[model samples]
Target: MLRSLHLRAISPEAKKVGLAAFLSATAFAAVLGITAPAQAPVERSVAAPAAASPDSVELQLLGVNDLHGRLESPKAVRRETGGAPVDIGGVAALDAHLDRAERSHPGRTIRVHAGDMVGASPLLSSRFHDEPTVRAMNLMDFDVGTLGNHEFDEGGRELTRLLRGGQRSDGGQFKRDAAGRKANTSAPDFEGVDFPYIAANTVDREGRLGLPPTRVIERAGVKVGFIGVTTTATPNHVLDEYTERFEWLDISDTVNRQASELRRRGVEAIVVLAHSGAYDVNGDPGAAAGEIIDEAREMTGAVDVVIAGHTHSRLNTRVANSDGLGDKLVVEANSYGAAFDRVRLTLDLRSGDVTAKSADTPTTWNDEVAPDPAVAALVARYRAALGGMGERTVGRLAEGLERAGSLSEVAARAQRRLANADVAFVEGGNSRGSLAEGMVTYDELFEASSYEHQVMRMEMTGAGVRRVLEQQWEAEPDAPLHVAGPDEAALDDDATYVVAANALLMDQDQFTAFREYGRGVRPVGTDLEALEGWISSRGRETGVGG
Candidate 1:
């Protein structure tokens, strides 16, 4: 039988140790295709139904979070019944899952996305400004969603255009044909989002919500209110310019206020679709904790369920609301469209209140489910538009390189070579993934350095460089800045040196030292092109793996 692990929040040290153990245990279960003998089922309390009768309604909530424009299936691991590593998470696979659920529940099901639907996407979708993803979501019939930090990557203006389609900010039109070629038309048609995007806590300069604060869906005489909220720390994650016009209100305050409004409107069964989540170490959702937990506890009597994302952690557990409205279900599906939260809510139709709810996260394994034909066709079109560039082999790696190690080194080398600077620096987070062994494709390389950052050359004193390196530790104690072309033994504190970095590192206020110390900043090439050129130029000489 499939068994669940009990997850609970532990100290950072304990987390690191526990994470290893958890991975090992899950991997063993996956490899054997059986539950570990020592593993125990997660315990959860189910509330008694509120006077069951013909008036009661059952609502099935199917939702995904942090898809990040994964139109294609990425690599994933499954442990439910000891499955081998599987290719998981494509729009088509997600569609299949949704299809099965909807067919089972029929009209009683509502498909919702938590957030991070776009931004930091693969080239296939990002190249088209994530229009393909929006189109895909529409095809999937997503009911509603909120925003995540990545949604603000390009700023509110672009976000507005995404929701209410029109010409891009630059007034350029780009409409692709079936073959993925841009049509020879002056104006490209862009379809706006069919479903509403709720942002209860995200307000404009005038302190008014830019989108609907909440949405009420009534079905079978039952009313359910969904309050959408993004993380309050959105500004810290996104470029300052993108968020200058907006304000992120307190999550708890916003949810409570919106819940009150929803209640006053004679709607109960309140759910908060928050783009923030707690970390679940085990299967116990309550055991996982984060900023969302405090926010959920604060909602107490107002909120019944919380569907969370952002942390990209799996959580299918419950937490008691401090205000004493019974236990509230909180859940998060792992990111990249790898999985989705399946929640069933039993509601009292007369009171329009949720009597009980249960949730679980199931992996969207591509091999197990046939692709949805329509979504598959849509993805194929976009893939063709990419023109096989992503698949072009750049070079070969003798061995796989971890994101922090070889990937970082390769990026630093590329910047140094492109800018001819004495020192090159790359933030750890900037390198998104690892480099696998064997033939590396442009797409694979792009995955490692996905951002469209422009190579920037700046002159900084050695002291400034050290300060910048030190800053990495200030924010993330464990993640140190990756540097190339700098020799500590030969370094001079007062000496001035040319440095190469991405524009994000140069302009962001958080890297004040880099900004203040940088001189003669100029863009050379995009990070993607530079990495590609660098790898291609290497041409298997010296081998990247070595």
Candidate 2:
């Protein structure tokens, strides 16, 4: 059953009217068994009974962030007792972990995502436009989610379609059933998302949110309100044309305003699901905190909990609210379903307020736990749809290609040649994985460059090249840009040269010098296809498998 909550503006003032109207139409939808009012009133009854007890009730919140459509577990990095890397994460294993957590918490548990549940997905899910991920979430019973920058990768229309459910623009269909069996006919229509996606800061040209701003969940006589928001820097990450109609408001102001409205409606226990996070350093989650901390500080004492993402860091610690609201719970689970934030809130039964809270981020290892059969079936269905593309031999490697060595140089050279430019630059991070020895498949190639980045050829002066290289030090310190063709020996300060790079690097604000100094910007092929052709050609030349 579809369930949702709509929170209208608390005041009718001119300034707040727009936010109120927007929120009233866009609030959390109950994907679980919980029910919420379609529209909440400004004032709510808060009278306590004479028999109100001093005892507290505990609520468990299990959350994941930056899932990024990892329907199956990726290669493991941590070793098991048997000296093998532990195979951890994937919807099935995650479902098992959730089951264990739910069984421990019983009726007091709720599941949530902090954003980036989709986008930059592997071919298994992205090939089908991330419908499988949504389906998996539905089976897992996610209560609520927020938008991430990646969710807007394909623009508002596609995102809207994913949330609303229907046939794809291309009228594609699932090729297999949930049990992994090939279907005799086309699969059913996409059912969209079962849960509501909330984003308080993202508003349309009409000042309306794309989804609900807040969602209230009541269970066992306790009510908790959640306000969801994406980072203000969303536009900087996504394509401009996709987000042209939307504006991001100040996160702190939006949360504070929404908290006020929720409080007036008798919601004293509040949580903020922000798609922004701080890095954990020296065992402190707030160490070198980012925008989420700023928003939490500005929230004063109105907000009690903050679940964050985007940085993909695993942290669980408390940050004191500026308004003397005690310590606010701030937590973030690592990305790609690797870990989850398990938070427990102790609520005062009499005051209807959260008295204390604590949280932990645990790895979702599949070593000991059996995969959830249903989720496994779902993943298999999508995996089957990948057909032979995943296994088709692309080339063979005599040895693994390291992200920072000759392999990267080779890739850059290939990109440069594909764009017919003097040099090409590829970020170290963009090389998601390395090419293993022996046969290399299309899947491995994709794993190396996971993003749907297109190649762009542009002209830049030698000075601009040096500036872009220098900018790398801003983050990676000694990290060098893998350049092909023009070595340091061939450097010319004022000479103009043609270069190629992934669209993200070319368009990023950090590399604005590329555009400011660049001329004759033209699109080449996608990074994947170019790399494929390059690898194929290399295989023929080297007499390797192709």
Candidate 3:
């Protein structure tokens, strides 16, 4: 479906000339000569940009977000193209899509990443510490990106190693022999990103800025300042062990501080590359609501556009800012390299402010172009490295598990069996993939639970176990807290029980209740390892998958 959003009111305003220009996604749909109804609608038009003059020049921003280290393609159907099933993801296809988009407007396009470039990934990338993903990003040439919650999954030190080249902490191409000499091995290739990843809201333990807040880029004599930030709710979602060493600043305050400084340095057009994300409410793109929406609306007038991610949803529309200067365009592509954004902005060469702007969201349809051969080869090499991985059937699922809750339940059960504990809990951390019905392989299990978190065995009384179960409901009404144990009715308050859970929960604030009763906490194998053991055992006994 080729379509564009056309608005009826709000032209150029004088205040916008020296001030700010806010707008949304309405112009790109028209590029294909298609009119669509799902786009965000304003009270007429959502644009607040200045009228175009001869001094105005066009600038483009190509954006992507929440890739999650998908080095290979995922089987997804493109909604815009009549729901035809095809391979739409993978670094190879994304490289192709980005290449084609950039060529259309040579020298005026900036490839942007909204965050989550790694973590919560498939076996091919996660096993190699996401080296393939970073290498692929460098190949595509991203201009600027921000930090997402998942990026901190392995802790701040490892993330630093990813951004700034350093020694591979774990398995890699070389190993130290008896003489401490480099030994050759078939390990992953590791390196840092070639682009700048900003983190305006991320702070160190001392409340000091951790990463560069903003970066200014000049195209066609027009300079646009980009501010990068993740949602402040990051600490809540990440491992407590990792988050304890860091602090999260407020999103709006962080952006304003950086935006103000950028303006003082003579930057007029400020674009925020935020890790925050939002969705079109009720299937209406214009009616977006989420943490990203709240941040967008609260942004000062100095900001122009917001490239957002994290919720892994679509948002192509204009929003009114708190400064009341005008509406600003907010765009987000879906996750796993599935889609991207092409935002066209009319920059006034005189004031350096965006005069007019419009954007469109396009799916990374590999069928549209020949996949980038280099990236495809890179993905192929990694797949071959894990020879016979697909054939190693761990267990069989009678039916596929599609939701995170189902997979979480599997994790919980595996941990219980591994620890021979009375129960196990699955909470916190991100669940990346789902299990398909049929014979489950080690490859599939890695995809199902990718987080590298150690499992902890805990001793708790039945009363405390009951309390934790109640706490799950207390936190969120009807929130599914994965637990593997005896029947609820059989759980006696006075009896003692052993619990298995991710090591992360012991430090997380939300699960602090566990600390109140947790005793004799000891480290068990990792969550993935437990699952592997459980599946292998089941696969051997049943001969019919789990």
Off by over 4 Å in 2: 1-54, 77-82, 170-188, 206-209, 283-288, 402-410, 460-480, 488-496, 539-546
Q: Per-residue lDDT tens digits of candidate 3, residues 387-493?
A: 56544777776666654666677778888887879998887333667778778877778777787678888899998888888777766433447888887788898
- Local accuracy by lDDT, each model: 0.76, 0.74, 0.74
Q: Give the Å shift of residue 474 in candidate 3.
A: 1.9
Which candidate has the top score in lDDT?
A: 1
Candidate 3, RMSD to the unseen true structure = 11.3
Higher lDDT: candidate 1 or 3?
1
Better of 1 and 2 by lDDT: 1
Q: How large an RMSD does model 2 have?
A: 11.2
lDDT of 2: 0.74
Positional deviation of 293 in candidate 2, in angstroms?
3.4
Model 3 regions lying over 4 Å from their true place: 1-53, 78-84, 170-189, 206-210, 428-430, 476-478, 539-546
- lDDT by residue (tens digit), candidate 2, 1-546: 011111212212112225554243223112221122344223222222123245878888889899988898976866547676877799878876776666556677778889999988877777677888987887677888889888988777778878888766633343343334643332346778878788888887844335878999886678999999899988867767778888889998999899998999998899899899888777665464767776777775868888899988977777777756487888999898888888888788777799777788878877645565446656765665665657878876666677556566667877887998888897665665577767778777776766767888989889888778777666523445677766756779799888898877776666667777778888887777677777777754563222
How well does candidate 2 score on lDDT at residue 258? 93
Which residue pairs of candidate 2 clash?
3-30, 26-212, 27-212
